[model samples]
Target: MTDKQRTDRGTREYRMGELAERAGITVRTLRFYRERGLIPPPRREGRIAWYDDHHLARLRTIAALLERGHTLSGIADLASAFDSGRDVGEVLGLGEPSEETPVRLTPEALSDYFEGETTAENLSAALDLGYLATDGDELVHISRRLLDVSSALVKEGVPLSAVLAAGREVRGHAEALASLFVELLRPHAAEGDLQRLRPLAKSVVDAELSLALDRRLRGS
Candidate 1:
């Protein structure tokens, strides 16, 4: 609490093992993260890696986010926000603001995770559609319902990237569709018409989505 107390407490630099223990992750996992480009290579003292509190902080943050189900790639975007000195408001789609913490992932690994015909593209598309995000080196589905939908699609041999790409491509069209409806309903509106029409808006959305599927089936 005083200047002398502050002076007495000095920074402690830890070796990889100690840092990993403090961060509640294995040393090997830390190394794996380094190899995956999720973490920076530690400082070396004659072939021995040394980590500081900063590294520990980053690891703790990663663990927390992962526990919260954020994928590594999504975490990376959130981390970038912090690196650029962005506030929590800029990073989290939230109600309150908090100080930024480090959250990151390797982009290459992310691309690789969804690369090939397996489902990388769809996974990437899921990320774009806000279905996925990085927690460290992991990808997370923000919506459990969406995750189930994606899983079903994957079972059908539909790549995640295609879905994500389609979502991205369709976003503009969706917005335009919404704009058209908003205008159409605007004419019959009252001062707090939005409140009265909230349930109707949901119904309209359901109808629109169903119509889209019906159109696709008919076309096929």
Candidate 2:
């Protein structure tokens, strides 16, 4: 079998030189990145080191981030954030989101979504808020709606930092609102009535928020 076809734990493994060739970097550059901890250490068997597809994906992500004007130091920080972020199963817990669609994004795709705003701080904040989770080499955003709204706000000239701050505030209010609705309904609700009546609570909040925005605009 070819060196490329070698299997490590049921996944394809490549020698350091072959990995560098596949990732379009020289062996020297790969070593530099490894030295800086940009990529995880490879699996070792005897005297030979075996890099996997995950390393290749990380290298490509690094290249993409560099193309988007990210400095190596900044990329290293971002990589740290990404690696340490929560996983999807942990974020979702016992139940998946009932109505919101989760979005799986490659690192480059996430950068595209926020342009130059995809900083380590913002990524860390999103992970802290449970809005983002890691799934292998990709990121899983908890809600497609929230993702779209955030991207739109950034495109509309709202700084991502401000957007994330606003989200934090909104999260508190949302949680309170949810608790209020649950308390109000729990006494009278049947076994599954709370789940069934969730949309009604959502509608009320949506309408109230729209009116609140209108009033704020008029007052301004």
Candidate maximizing lDDT:
2
Steric clashes per prediction: 21, 0
Question: Worst ten-residue run, lDDT, model 2?
Answer: 1-10
Question: Model 2 clash pairs?
Answer: none
Stretches of candidate 1 off by over 4 Å are 1-14, 20-36, 41-129, 133-142, 208-212, 215-219
lDDT of 2 by residue, 145-205 (tens): 9999999999999999899999999999999999999999999989688899999999999
Instruction: State in Å the error of residue 23, model 2.
Output: 0.7
Tens-digit per-residue lDDT, 1-220, candidate 1: 1111111246466777777788788879888766655555676668766666556666776676576556777655554433333232333476321322332334333333333332233443445455445543333434444445545665687766665666567667768876776777788887478557656766888897899999999999
Judge candidate 1 against the unseen true structure and give its global Cα lDDT, from 0 to 1: 0.56
Give the residue spans of candidate 2 off by over 4 A. Answer: 5-9
Candidate 2 local lDDT, residue 8: 38
Candidate 1 local Cα displacement, residue 74, angstroms: 16
